[model samples]
Target: MNPFRHGLLAARTAAVMPHRQRQLATLSAEGNAPLSVLFYHRVADSHPNDWTIGCQRFRRQIDYCERYFELIDLAEMQLRMERGESRRPAVCLTFDDGYRDNSDFALPLLIQRRIPCTYFVCTANILNQTPFPHDEAAGQPLAVNSLEQIQAAADAGIEIGCHTKHHVDFSHVHDERTVRDEIIHAKSELENLIDRPVRYFAFPYGLPEHLTQVAVDAVIEAGFDGFCSGYGAYNLPGESPFHIRRFHGDPEMARFKNWLSFDSRKLRKNFSLDFRLPASRIPTLPVPTTMTPAFSVLG
Candidate 1:
C-alpha cells in the first residue's frame, strides 16, 4: 500500500483496461470465461503477518466480489464446468491453514451473507492445539482453529477441506506411504471430527515445485472431488476441472482486481504441473445417489 507500489499498480491497470475489456468480450463470446478461486489465510487486526489480512480490508474485498463477480463454491464451480462454458466470470473464495482469527469476522461475515467458501485446515494443528510452523518461524505464533470452531463452521454450512495432517510440503516428500498418510489420514481425521464426507484436498505451499506426482496421485486415488494449488493462477474452461487453480487473496485490492480483471500478463503466466496420469486414473466428482462412476479421465 506504499505510494510507489500504488503508482505501479495504477499504471498497470491503465495499461490493461482496454485489453481486459477485449479479453472478457472474447472469452464471454466463447462461453468459457475463466473461473477464479481466491485463497486467504487469516483475518484479524492484531499480530499482522504475511498470511494475515486486516478485517476491514477483507470486508471491502468481499463487498467488491459481491458487486463485480458471481461468488460460488467449488462444487458449484465444478458443476458449471461440467455443464460447459459459462458466459460470465465467477469466483470461489477459500482460506488456507485454518487460522483461529478468521472466526472473529471473516467466517461470521461469510456465514451471514450466505457466501460459499471452502475452509482447509491442517489436522495436527487443530488436534494438538498447536501453532503452524510457519507462524512460529515468523515469531508471531498465532493461534490455530480448534476442533469445536471447525465443527461450528461446518454446522453453519461452510465446507471444511483437508490441508494434510502437518502441512508437509509435498516437494520434499518422496515416499508414497508418507504422502498417503498425510493426505488420506488427514481426510479421515477431518471427516471424523466434522461427521461428514470430506470432498477436497489442497496442497500446502501449493506451487508447481511444491507439488509432486506422488501427492497428486494419492489425491486421485483417495477419491477427492478435486485438488487445489496456490501459486496464483486461473482455472480456465476446457482444462481439467478437477485440478482447481487458485490465486492469492492478499490485502492488496489493486493486485486482486488485476488478477480478476484478466490482466494479460497474469493470463499468460502458467502454473500447471504435469502429473502424467492417464484419463482413467482421474476419478469423477460426487454425483447423486442414483448415479454411478464412469471412471472418467481427470482432465
Candidate 2:
C-alpha cells in the first residue's frame, strides 16, 4: 500500500471503533437512527479470500442482520431516508461483480431466506462470458454471472444494478463519449436482460480518486436513482439521492461484526477522518453458524 493509504488505515485502526457501536446502540435504544449499507462480492465455499465468504457464514450473517435491522430494499431505504421516517438503524446488503458463484451459491440462500439484495453487474463481462480483468491479473480467472442466472435473481425479486459496460475505470477515462457509453449502455443492457428498469449504479473501482466528476454526471444523466462507492462512511436517514457508501465485508464472523458494529470510519466520508478520537469497548463478536435462515419473505 502507498504511504497515504497505509497511514489512513492505521489511523482508523487506532480510532477505538467500538465507541461508535456503543453510541449507535444507545441511539437505537432511544430510537433507530443509524444506517449502514454493507457490500459483498462473492459467496462460495472456496479457498480463503478477502472478497469471498463461505455459504454457511453468509447465511448466518443474513440471519443476524434480519434480527437486528429491517432489511429494506434500496427503494424503501431511499424513500424512508428522504421522508425522514426510519425508526431504527437500517442495513442493506449489496454485492458487486456479478459472479456466477453469487448465483450458484449465494442466490440460493438469499432466495431461501427471502432477503433482499442488489447485485451490481458488469454487463460486458457477463455478455462476453469473461473473467474480470483483475481476476486475470491475479492468475485466478473466475466466471462472471450469466444472464440466465441474473434473470433468475431478478425473478426471485433481487434488485439488478449496474456496474458499467465492462467495469471501465472511470478515473482514467477522459473521453466524455466513453463515460456516457459506459454508464448508459450498461444500464440499458441490464434492463433488457432483467426486463425491468435499472434504478441504481455503483462506480467501477468506486474510490474518489478512481472516479471523476464526469463519471458522476454520466450516471445522473443516464437516469439512475442513486449510485454507490466502494468504501466510505455509513448513511444515516435523511441523506437523499442515496449515494451509498459501501465497505467490503470480511468472511470471519468476529471481524465482520467488528466492522458492522464499530468500524471508526463509519462516520467519515470515504473513511477519512480529520480529527483524532481515542478508542472505546470492543464487543465480543458472534460465532459463525451453519443454520438456515428462519424465514423466507419469498415463501
Candidate 3:
C-alpha cells in the first residue's frame, strides 16, 4: 500500500464514518438502505495492477462485510428488492474477469466461509487459455481461469456469470447479430461447461459509457436472470433489482470501508440507471416447469 495514499484515505474515512454509520442506521430503519454490490477483477500480490488486490486485503474486506453487513447472493438480494422488504444494510460480492490466481486463494476463502460470490468470466479467453487484451496491453499477461476451475466454482455453489465471449464493450457494438452472439451464445457455451443455468451477466467496463440500449435489450431478450453495471452506485428498495449497480472494490482497506460504509459524498451523488425494466420483469426464482421460451429461434 502507498503510505501517502493510504494515510489520506484513512483520515477521510475516520472523519466521516460515524456520521455515515448513523445515516445508514436511519436508512435501514426506514427499510431503504442501499444495497452495495462490489466487483473485483483480480486478487494477488505479484505484479499488481490497477485491478489487482492483495490476498490479505481481500480477506480483510470479507471480514469487514461479515461484521457490518448482511452478505447475500445476487439472487436473494434481488428477491428482497422485488418484495420491497430490504430492511438491512447488505452487500453482494462479485469478481469480474476470471483470473487463475484467484483460484489459488480468494475463491477458496469465499468457498470455505460459505460466502456468496458471483464469478464472471470472458469465455474466449478461458477457452483459448489466453490473457485478456487489457492485461496484454499492460505487459502483464495474467493467466485466465480454466474451464475445470469454473465448473468447480459452480459445483462449490458460486454463481458463474457471463462477461461476454471476448469481453466486448457493448457501447461499440451496434448490430443485433453481434449482440445476440455475445449475450446469448456466450451464456449457452458457459452453461454447457458448468451444467447449470448461468443466470447473471455483468457488462464489460460496466460504466454508462460502456453500455448501449441495444446490448441491454439483447440481454433481456436472452432470458438472463439479471445484469450488472459497475458505475459506482447503490441499488435501493422499490427500484428494478434486475439491473445491479456495483462499486469498484479497491485494494486499500480504508477506501473499501469508506465506500461501503455509506460514505456521505457518494450516497448523495448516487443515481440508478434507467434500464426501463419494471419490477414485474424481475425473474422469479425456481422458474416454473411449465414456462415456455419468450421467443422462438432467431435467424
Candidate 4:
C-alpha cells in the first residue's frame, strides 16, 4: 500500500482507539456524555453538481437524529455544561460558513419543525459577497446568507455563531495578530450586525491540529463561550470548551447508521491494528473510509 494510505489508517486508528475507551468509560459511568454535533455547508437539494446531501436524504438524517437524540439548542447545551448537569444523549445542531441556502432552505425547514439551530457565518464572505475558496475553485457561486437574512433568522429563533473573518485556516497561519484578528474581529462584526452577543466560534475547515493552542486561547480571551472543531467525537464533561469535536453526516443511510453506532473502543482497536501497518498500505485496505468526504453531498 502507498504511504498515504498507511498514514491515513494509522491516523484513523489513533483517533478511534481513544474514542472507544472513552465510550466504554461513559457506558460504565453514571451518565452518558452529552453529544453536540456540528455540520458544515449543507446543500439545499441533491443535484449532480453538488457535494451536499439531497433534500430527501437530508430530511431522513434529520429525522433520525431527532428521533434518537433529544434535540437541544446550543444555549441549552452550554447552560447544562456550565451547570454540570447530566445530558441525556441529546444533540445540538450547528451549521458552519453562513451558506445562503441556510437561510433559503435550512431556515424554513428548521422553523417549520420548530427546531432551533446555530449558524456560524464568516463575516468577510458576507461583507464582500464572495464565495468560499473551495466554492470558487469549483466554479460555484457564493451561497451564503446576507446580513439582513441572517438577522431575520435570528428573529425566527436561529442562533448565529462566528466562523472567522476570511475563513482563513488558523492552524496554517503563523501571525499571532492575524489569528486574533480573524477570531476577535470577526466576533465583533457578527455581534454588531446581529444586535446580540456572539458567543460561539467554529474553526473554518476544522481539522486535527488546525487551530493552534495560542489561537484557541485568543478565542477564549476574545470572550467566546466556546468553540468547535470538525473532528468526530462527543464532548465529555471538562473537555476543553474551545476544541470540541464533531462528526460529518453522509447522504447514505447505512453510513449514518455506522456513525451513530460508532463506539470509540472499536475504533481504537481498529486504528491500533491499522497503525501497525505500513502507511502506504492503509488506504488500499478495506478499512471503512465512509467517514471521509468521498461521497459527501457537498463535496
Candidate 5:
C-alpha cells in the first residue's frame, strides 16, 4: 500500500466524510439501497496502462462485489429502478471502448461466473482496427475487439452499447447533424453488426461539461434505454433514463474498496431523482467556475 495514498485518504475521510456513513447504512425495503454502475476500459495481464487492469485484480473485484451486493447489467438495473427495488445495493460492470483483451481475458471469466456486463464500443475503430485518439495520445494504443469477437461476446450474453463512432466529444456539438451521425447513426451501425438491438448509450469522455442537450435529444430521438455520465455518482433507485451515472474502478484492492464504499453523492450538488418521461430531469450540475475540474480525473 502506498503511504501517500493512505495519508490522503485519511485526510479526506476526516474532511469530506460525514459524521455517520448514512450512505451505506441507510436502506430501502427488502434490504436494498441503490445502484452503482462501475465502468472499466480494459482488462489484460500485460501492457498495463492508465485504462488497463490486470485479469487477477478484475476477478477479485468481481468476487468481492458479488459477495457484498448483487451484480447486475444495465437492463436489470433499469428494471429494478422502474420497479422501485432498492432493498439491497446493486452494481453493474460496464466497459467502455471494447478492447480485444476483453475477449481474451475478461470474457471467459465473466462467462464462467455468468456475470453480465455491457461493452460500449467505438464502431469505427473496431471496423478499422485503429486505436482511439485517447489511447494513442496516452502512448498505449492497443488492439480493439473485432466484429466477430464482439458478436461472439454478445452471443455469450454480454450487452453491447454504442460509445459513438469516433469517440467524439459531445460538449461542443451544437448542431443536430453531428448528433445524428455520432450518436444516432453509430447506434444503428452497431446494431447491424451484432444483429441485436443495442439499447444503452454511453457518453465518450463522460463528464457533465462533456454533455450537451443536443446529444441527449438525439439519443432520445434514437430511442435508447439510457445514457451514462462519468462523474463519481451513484444511481438512486428511481432515476430518469437519460441521467444514468458511472464510476471508475480501481485495481488496487484497498483503493478499490475505498472507492466502492465511498458515497460519491456527497460530492454532488443539487442532485435528485426525477423520473419523468420525455426524459428531462437530469440533476443540475454545479457551474464550472472552479479551476479544479480541469485537473481532476475521476473517469
Candidate 6:
C-alpha cells in the first residue's frame, strides 16, 4: 500500500475504534436498530481490479452480514421498515445493471446459503445485449444475463427490479416523455420476462441532487413499491422509500473488515461534512481506493 493510503487506514482505525466498540456494546444491550441497509454491485472474482472481489473475500463479507444482520428480501425489509418495527438491523442485497457474472458467480453462493436477493436490471441491455457506455469507454463489455438465465434465477426465488431501459441519466434527459418511457418500459419488460409484478426500481447512478421531483413522481406513477440509490447511509423509520442509501464495499479483505468495524453514524457524518466542503479545500485521506470495475463483473 502507498504511505498515504496506509496512514489513512491507520487514522480511520484509530478514530473509529472506540466508537465502534461502544456501538457494539450498546447494540448488544439495547439491541440493533431496525435500520435497513442496502448493498449494491458486489462481485466475487479477483483483486487489483475495480468492482470485483475474490471469492474468499466475498464469502467472508456474506458470512459477516449473515451473522450481524437479519438477511431479508427487499420486500420484507420495506414492509417491516414501513411498519416502524424495531427488528434487528437487517440488510437487503441488490445488484444494479443485471450482469451475467451475477448469475455465474454470486448466484451460486447465494443459492447455497439460501440468502434472498434482488437484481435491478436495465431492460434494453438484456434485450439488445449491448454494453453500457461507461463499460464501452473503459474497453470493457457488459455481461448482462440472458432472459432464460434471469428466469431461472427468479425460479430460484430472486426478485428482479427495474433499472430503466437504457441506463440513461434521467437528469440530463430534458424530455419528460422520454424519462417516463424509460421508467415504464423497463418495468414492463421485466414483468413480462419474470411473469410477476415488478414493484421496485433503482435509479441509475442514483443521487439526490441529480434525481429530480419529476423523475420521482414519474416512478411513483408507474406503481413501484420503492426505489433505491447509490447513496451511502442507513435507512431509518419514515425515510423516503423512493430514495434509499447503500454502502460501497471494497473487494479487499482488509477494507471489508474496516467497513464492518465502522460506525454507520461516523460514515454518514464524514460524507455529509465532505459534501459541504469547497471542492479545492477538501482533504484527501489515505485509504483503499474506491472500486470502479464494470457493474457486470461485480459477481
Count of backbone clashes, every candidate in sequence: 1, 2, 0, 24, 5, 4
Which candidate has the top score in lDDT? 3
Q: lDDT by residue for model 4 over 1-299, one digit each (tens)? A: 46677567556645554554455346425554455564746657733344466666677777766665566665555544444554355566788887776666667887777776778888988888888876777877657678888889888878789999888886679798999899888898889988998877888887656757767777777877677777666654443333455666655555454455444432332111111111111111222111111111110
lDDT of 1 by residue, 1-299 (tens): 78998999877766776677677767868987778899999999999878889999999998877776678788767766666676667788999999998998999999998888999999999999899888878888889999999999999989999999998988888988999999988898889999999988999999888778888888887778888888888877766778888999968877777887766567655545677543432335533211111211111
Local distance difference test scores for all models: 0.81, 0.70, 0.82, 0.64, 0.74, 0.64
Q: Which one wins by lDDT: 3 or 5?
A: 3
Q: What's the lDDT for residue 296 in model 4?
A: 13
TM-score of each: 0.90, 0.80, 0.91, 0.75, 0.83, 0.79
In angstroms, give how far residue 32 of model 3 lies from its true place.
0.9
Q: Can you write out model 3's per-residue Cα lDDT over 103-175, one digit (the tens) per residue? A: 9999999888888899999899999999987888898999999999998989997889999999897778878
Expressed as tens digits, the lDDT of each residue in 196-216 for candidate 2 is 989889987777776577777
In model 5, the runs with Cα more than 4 Å from the true position are: 1-25, 30-32, 262-299
For 107-226, candidate 6 gives per-residue lDDT tens digits of 788877778778888888888888776677777775777888888988887778888999878768868888888887678878997898887788887776656666676777777767
RMSD after CA superposition, every candidate: 6.3, 9.6, 8.2, 11.8, 8.7, 10.1
lDDT of 1 at 92: 89
lDDT ranking of the models: 3, 1, 5, 2, 6, 4
Model 4, backbone clash pairs (residues 3+ apart or across chains), number? 24
Candidate 6 runs further than 4 Å off: 1-18, 24-36, 42-49, 254-299
Backbone collision tally, model 5: 5
Where does the lowest 10-residue lDDT sum fall in candidate 2? 275-284
Cα-based lDDT at residue 67, candidate 5: 69
TM-score computed on alpha carbons, candidate 6: 0.79
